[model samples]
Target chain A: MSLSSLPSVSTARSTASLTADAAALPPRAERFGRALLGSLLPLCLLALWALASRQGWIGRDLLPSPGDVLRTTETLVLSGALFHHLAATLARMLAGFLIGAAAASLLGALAGSSVLVHASLDPLIQGLRSVPSIAWVPLFVLWFGIFEASKIALIAVGVFFPIYLNLASALARTDSRWDELAAVCERGRLARFFLIALPASLPAYITGLRSGLGLGWMFVAAAELMGASQGLGFLLTDGEQTGRPETVLTAIVIFALCGRASDRALAALAARLAWR
Target chain B: MAEAVAVRDLVVNFGERAALGPVSFTLAEGSITALVGRSGAGKTTLLRCLAGLLAPSRGEVKMLRGQGRPRIGYVFQDARLLPWLSVAGNVAFGLTHLPRAERREAVAKALAQVGLSGWAHARPGELSGGMAQRVAIARALARAPDLLLLDEPFSALDAFTRRHLQEELRLLLHRVRLTVVFITHDLDEAIALGDRLLVMAGPPGRIVADLPVSDTGGALLKRQVLALLEGSGEEALQSPTLRVLAAHAG
Candidate 1:
């Protein structure tokens, strides 16, 4: 029961040393493991689906088999219809999310640093943040019509609060001692912000950005579902109208896949840039 | 001799509570002074005021006598390094006015003087407590300031590291002849490191004692001087450490 003697300190050290050595050489093994995991995940999901369909675990009409969904997806891919719809969704998400995140960071820094600014605007922002972006759909429609403006507005609203709150909280947590230290060092106010405040707040800002992207994806889909002629959501609506369960499942699968890919890409980019 | 630091009627108050002097003190040019006191004694407060990190509630801190630029270097107890910066970057943070090559060379020389040549690229988080403190000292050293203010710079360090750094500090001061004011609760540290010790005590801070110490001064002289400032305890003169420990224990 006791295998305490199996790996001594030296043994553990050598093993760690070997791993470190391998890690120093381009990370190919790590990349291969990631690729293998990526490939296996969908395969496992498909196998589960096939088993379910064969046994009639769920009604075939409601939940199409992976094969049926794949056929629909392949057709859409060949026709480049999925690509067109995906591009539209991505464009809206990126544009709206960037605009919301930038404005929030700037305003958040201002509010966080100045008590007067925070006092003037904090109650209004808190009230606005509490209201869901989806609840604004009717108002947005009236304000900007059913075009892309409404969708962008909804997505921007969804993404704004998380980024703003996170950034503001981060800036608020900035130690006054650091500012005093900077003054002692004779650094200017702008230099102090760039060197200390910005770097210190980066981790919190990144956390906010990550959460905002999730909300953004959710809002974009909801906006499309409520009103859109051509999108993945529209395709789902089209499938429902046509009475094609397979096409509906294909559209849902594509939406999930794109969302996962975007999140993964974001995580990868965050890994590269984030300090801690 | 030029006046390194000239202060007149320096007063600092935390609301109604007084922290430091309405008293006056002059720091002679290129001399080391130690500020000593019990806990909550305003030693650190006085050091901070001199460093320009804190403005006096009422008083003038004339760092330079007339026209020359007055650069003040600082070494804090915790070695408050920027976690994200490499040792070289942290050391060179204040030296932007210098050319890039000169700055790098200065950082390199400062690190070498602190016996941290190998740790130039390491992050502060990656260093030991002693190493981190050394880097902080190197950072101040690199600034080549007119006045160096250290607040318990080596109190947190291990005994061996503390002794080594004390020696290093003594040698660095000899080479650069920088004016320094160090704060410490330790009497031995004050005696060993200071050219003059200014002991401040209680309520509205007033200088209780001003004792001059020299390299030639023996342990007996140090004990006698500290004993004089600490007030009467006939038995306390035998051993200063034991006396201080006994007083604290009681």
Candidate 2:
């Protein structure tokens, strides 16, 4: 009837509202300054850790100095041990992430589009989602036998739910107005799904991917820690068993770097697609 | 003008409740009609019926072709633009069935028609409310659909922008004769744009009065529409309508 009659206008779309105000980019110098400022806190933290270890405020047995951790990393890299561990973990995470994301998005899209599918699948998914990441470790290890398969499966589990939930909810919550427009446009079901539903769901889907990737890293750590012979997780165990604090610290630093790098890569992709 | 559509005794229900019609009307080809009503008055339901989005529970809406099959262009209350697409891409949305070169030409022409030349590359986020709405209108125009349906397309806009677009719509029509049906709560907007007016009212919505406005904005017509939409819809419905004899709109 009247525009006033509709429950709410969808002009304030969650997807658009986030980026609507971001029309203009900040100056290069300003953006560079912001990035420099972002690094300041971490740099300060590094300085403090180095100071603490040097002054004996924190003993090397407890927390190694930044220099000791960096030297250990250097040794690992030169000896090719770091590459071996990194490649092993990256490969596992990649496989797990691909499997988990593919399955989640496929199901999520179906559930989002149809009530019957959602009703059929959501309860089981929600129930499984509640089961702790660590809890799955024993069950997976038993099934896959304390090997790469079990480790990868655990990572996949971690990656799945965030993606599934985010994607499903996003697609499900898409503004009905677009559906009306599609009806008016006389779009086929396939065109509606791909052209309207998918694009509308992209922001949340990307957000889901980011969260899934983050959880993938966390679950990979847990997976490797539980039963691994060659990973950063294995390095953590090796350092712990050998009483080498520097080696553990090295592994932690590498994990942090890798996680940050992977997240940045996805974030870059998001930026490219975000109202650009 | 040929008859564009004939909606006869159309009724729509949402579960137990009647949402629209049990009313009847016919549309003239290349005519501009406005449906004026309060909230929940079945204006959108009727519009959707014409667009083939809603099926009537009773009665039927028949579209009588004049020449080639009529393509429909709809402008929703909100822009309903795809945020990922550029302004040109959004305009090109319906033109996907056309060849690429034809689609591109239509997009450029539609954008230019809406006075949005050189805005092809701008993202939806970059545009203001008025600009975005203009892009939406351009998107509708790019399809070159002879039957145009707008649902309060300018109501969400500022008064100045709304008035500007209203005038622009009239100007655009001068270049191409098309049948247009728009719904608005604003009596003034209905009178300003419509060649014929369908004033609708109620929870079980029906047309209370169907009136015509002359080229000069209809002041007398506005008062009747306002009264029909005021409180209980029955005031106009129970009374033997003047237009039933004079207009014979149905």
Candidate 3:
């Protein structure tokens, strides 16, 4: 008998159920409306800020007027200072994230595959995990000096732990059934690790990477506050010392936007790579 | 018939508790043996031991092999497809050592055998349970194993899906000519699928009865097997037909 002639009982059932679920979902316009509704509060707050500044209710020295901040932002953009600082911060963030994520994933994979390695290293990792990234900043500066190395080291430390811990746990928690399947297939140890273990642990690994990226941004800012002269964090400190509220607000805004953009990008990449 | 699998005093233990054996059996080549037992009767343990997933606490299992490496295919209760891989990719998983062209051909053949040729690019997540299980079977089939081991492969599906796949699998097995040992708790499924039916009973788990299934006596054999499963050991031993079956099995 031809396979095509056979009735697709389960497939039909699943398809019907999925169709019903899709039907029950809110329409596309309603989803768009909901997203638009979510943005209302933020827009309202921005409007209020502008209104108060226009009414002279907020002192310009203490809190820059929206108009003044906008003017300052335009000046910075035209002068290319904003781009230079933004590029510096972004470069530091990417470099630190790549270094930290690479090392953590490699170490995590090793530890996850071997119980002895995990047992030996887990306590040390767990101990270091509790210390804030800022706490390591002074020590890092002392050791590496207040150059790009210290700042990069600080961000890397901040990025490393989350990826390491999550990836390790993910590897440990990999469904034993997959290993059994690999064994049954007569897959070699290297094949099992690369094909089964690595892919199986990816969802958790991606989660770790995303968290690490967010922390990377935070650590880069903190590191720059100490001895950096070119990054956004430097801009923040410089603004504070000069009592330029506009500059400080600009730095904060840029950081918020960059953080959000990087997170979204990471999420997109993870979604593409994730099994589920 | 040549023996495809032979076992002697196989035993499996977890810590202090014995899970299976002090049991033994020889399965003929190109035969389907259904292992029926109550839940926790160590049927899975026995199958796992045969697959070399778990080491036996005592004794040995030997498969009849000629010169080359032994190939064993295992189908678990779950489909166990790597969620990231496409259907073709999953089927071709065990064929990684083969040349790319051979691997693709093997994957295509396996998928066709399971009637999933059209779904080569689909992800496992998109597949229905029965379809996913079929993919799992195809994955195993791609390896062209000497022996196939299935642990309640159809038990997770709905009755209709299970029944459909059982028929499909029976046909597939006939075409492939592979030796198979499958575990199940359903008496009817055992009767329907197996050339030989082995019953396991116990706290420590041992095979109590092994019957060579003849096509003519299926209903009667099923009833006797059900009785032996439901009744006490003394009653099972007292049944004359069961006695003959057990004697024939030995």
Candidate whose DockQ is highest:
3
lDDT of 1 by residue, A51-73 (tens): 99989999888888888888888
Interface RMSD of each: 11.7, 8.2, 3.0
- Model 3, range A1-276, lDDT digits (tens) per residue? 543355663355468558655755677998899889999998998899988887889888888777778888899999999999999999999889999999898889888989999999989988988886688878987898889888888899989998998899988888888878888887888988888888888888998998899899889998899878899999999999999999999999899999999999988888777774
Candidate 2 has a DockQ of 0.33
Q: Which pairs clash in the backbone of model 3?
A: none
Candidates' C-alpha lDDT: 0.78, 0.83, 0.86
Cα error, residue B218 of model 3, in Å, equals: 1.4
Q: Chain B vs. true chain B: TM-score for each candidate? A: 0.86, 0.92, 0.95
TM-score of each: 0.85, 0.88, 0.93
Ranking of candidates on TM-score, top first: 3, 2, 1
Q: Which is the leading candidate under lDDT? A: 3
Which 10 consecutive positions of candidate 1 chain A have the poorest summed lDDT? A1-10
Better of 1 and 3 by lDDT: 3
Which pairs, if any, clash in model 2?
A1-B44
lDDT of 2 by residue, A70-113 (tens): 88989999999999999999999999999999999999999999
Off by over 4 Å in 3: A1-31, B247-250
Sort candidate 1 into its docking category.
incorrect
Clashes of each: 0, 1, 0
What TM-score against the true chain A does chain A of each candidate get?
A: 0.83, 0.90, 0.90
Q: Candidate 3, residues B1-250: lDDT per residue as tens digits?
A: 8988899999888999988878988988999999997887789899989998889999999987544667888999999999878889889888866899999999999999998888899878677788899999999989888889999998899897788888888889889988999998777788788889988886577888988888788888888788777855456667776687788766
RMSD of 1: 7.0
